[model samples]
Target: MQLITWNTQWCRGLDGVVSAQRIVDGARAMADFDVLCLQEIAQGFDNMPGAPGDQPAELAALLPGFQVFFGAAVDEFDAQGKRQRFGNLIATRLPVARLQHHPLPWPSDPSVFSMPRMCTVVTVRDPVLGPVRIMTTHLEYYSQTQRLAQVHALRELNAEACAQAAAPPKAETEPSPFQPKLHTPHAIVCGDFNLTVSRPEALVSAPEYQAIHRAHAHGRLQDAWPLAHGDTPHAPTFRLFDRTYGPDPVTADFVFVSDSLAPRVQRVEVDLQSRASDHQPVLIAL
Candidate 1:
């Protein structure tokens, strides 16, 4: 399976134009990806400069014959009482078996600006691996406290999934909601983790990020970059062209695979040339 995960920044490019078509074109230019995971999609928020106001619909229209799953991390109303949503999206051509929208922890962080975050998981039937979970998310960017809590929540969710996979529920005789869903230890979790800085070693060198590695490691989620590339440095994924957010580029986005899928991880790459968004896209082939 091959997948690409990117933070589209509401499909806004460095040129200050929001075009879902451009985003789709950029990804297609990079590779023939079977699945696409995106973050920071906006809907019904025209106040954002150049926003189309319904990006999910626009993107779905762009990708025909592909199942698109969108989960709103921030859902609220504007001054005019129009509904607004900002969240992540997962698009795949594979046969989907189950999908779940999980809201991450949102603790009180009065000192910093933060927003509700979420992870959207889709279980697609991979011909080789059977039921495989593709989880995508975007964590809190501004608040470290909230981001840490969100990371813990993600680890817990992974643990639950692993547990369910290990112990299948009592099978139902009839087909219904209670019917046990497809369970497998195979999973790929990828997104813009918002875990980078001016330092090139920021991906794994930081103490907080180290803890994150350990947490996910305990849950069977290992960074696919090292598993595939081995000691090679990760290519920067954020602030490459704009540099408005930071003086230098760093890799905030990542792809983590469960231990069961790590051996199948064939390649991990970053498209450095695409300026479709402020953040670059990361690709993983398994």
Candidate 2:
């Protein structure tokens, strides 16, 4: 299985334009990804240029045979009386057995900072592996405080999702549209975390991120790339448009695998040249 995660910046490319087809083509050029996890997907918010449009469905329509799941982190009406939305998205070729949207802790920071963040978890039946969970999220970029809290929330959600499925051994439980069977609780969590693992001074090196690491210390959650490449530097996942490269293209995006599925993590690919969005896509194979 091949999974790709990217923050499409509302599907806007370097040309300073939002093109749905460009986003689709850029993604397809990166890899024949089985599952694509995206962040900063806009669904026609009035404040944005083309406000109140169903861009998710629009993108999905372009992809012929993929199951699309939208997690609306920011759902509200703009001043123009149009519905505006912002959130993460998961596109998969496999059959989805269940889907859930998790809203993160948003802060009331006055600074032009913390926007709403969210995560989407989907349970799907892979052709090779019977069942698996794929989660995609974008964390708070401006405020470290909110981002840290959101990290904790993410850990809790992971535990809750697994526990819900691992509750009983009954042949069949309450049939629900949002829950799935849990044979082994395999999962892949990916997206633009906005917290760089490369900088020790970064928020990811703080106690909150450490808490997330501790939760995974049991080996339940592991970063996929370092698992495959031990000594690799932060691999520069973001770049300012080709006009000029700054101090560094921050490494904020990630692809994480649960402990049970880490061993099968075959290869990790970080396409630095993928300019479909402000951030590049991180791909993982199993």
Candidate 3:
């Protein structure tokens, strides 16, 4: 299976053009991806910079056969009753078995600006990997307090799934609404983590590292970069073409895989050339 994860910046490129078509075409050029995970998709709020509303709908229309799921981290309605949503998306060619929207922690942090964040999780039947969960999310950018809380929430989510997978509750009736769906320890979590790291290539386990953003999953999760590239430093995914965030380039995007899925990581790469969005697309093949 080949998967691509990108923070499309609401489909806005560094050149100041917001085009979902361009984002899709660019990702296609990078890899023949089976699963596409994206963060920071916007809908129905046309006021934001270059945001063409209903991006999830636009993206879904772009990929016909793929099953698409959009989880809105922020859902609001204006006085005119028009709804607006912003969050993560997952589209996969594989058979989608289950879909979930998990809202991450949004603790009060008066010191800095922040927003609600979420993880969009979809379970797909990979012919070789069997049942696999693909989780994609974007963390709070400005506040470390909120980011750390969100990180633990994600880990808790993984722990919950692991527990459910180990022992599913028995269902007394057939075709019941309460029937437990397929849950697996095999998972790939990816997106714009919005947290930077120094020497990510140096550390192998037990931490997100910098008070770190990526939760090490307590031995359950492993960064895919080191698994593929060893000690080579991570290629910067943010502020590469546009350095408004910092003077030098930094990596705020990543892909983390459960230990069970680590060996299946045949290849992991970043498309350092594309300017479709501020973030470079990260691809993993199994």
Best by TM-score: 1
Error of 3 at 106 (Å): 0.3
Model 3 agreement with the true structure over 128-220: per-residue lDDT tens digits: 999999999999888877887888888778877877787777864667777767878888889888766534454333234333334443436
Over 4 Å off in model 1, which ranges? 215-218
Stronger candidate by lDDT (1 vs 2): 1
Runs in model 3 lying further than 4 Å from the true structure: 198-207, 210-219
TM-score of each prediction: 0.96, 0.87, 0.93
Error of 2 at 94 (Å): 0.2
* Candidate 3 worst ten-residue window by lDDT: 204-213
Relative to the unseen true structure, what is the Cα RMSD of model 2? 3.1
Where is the poorest 10-residue window by lDDT in model 1? 210-219
Better of 1 and 3 by lDDT: 1
What lDDT score goes with residue 194 in model 2? 71
Ranking 2 against 3 by TM-score, winner: 3
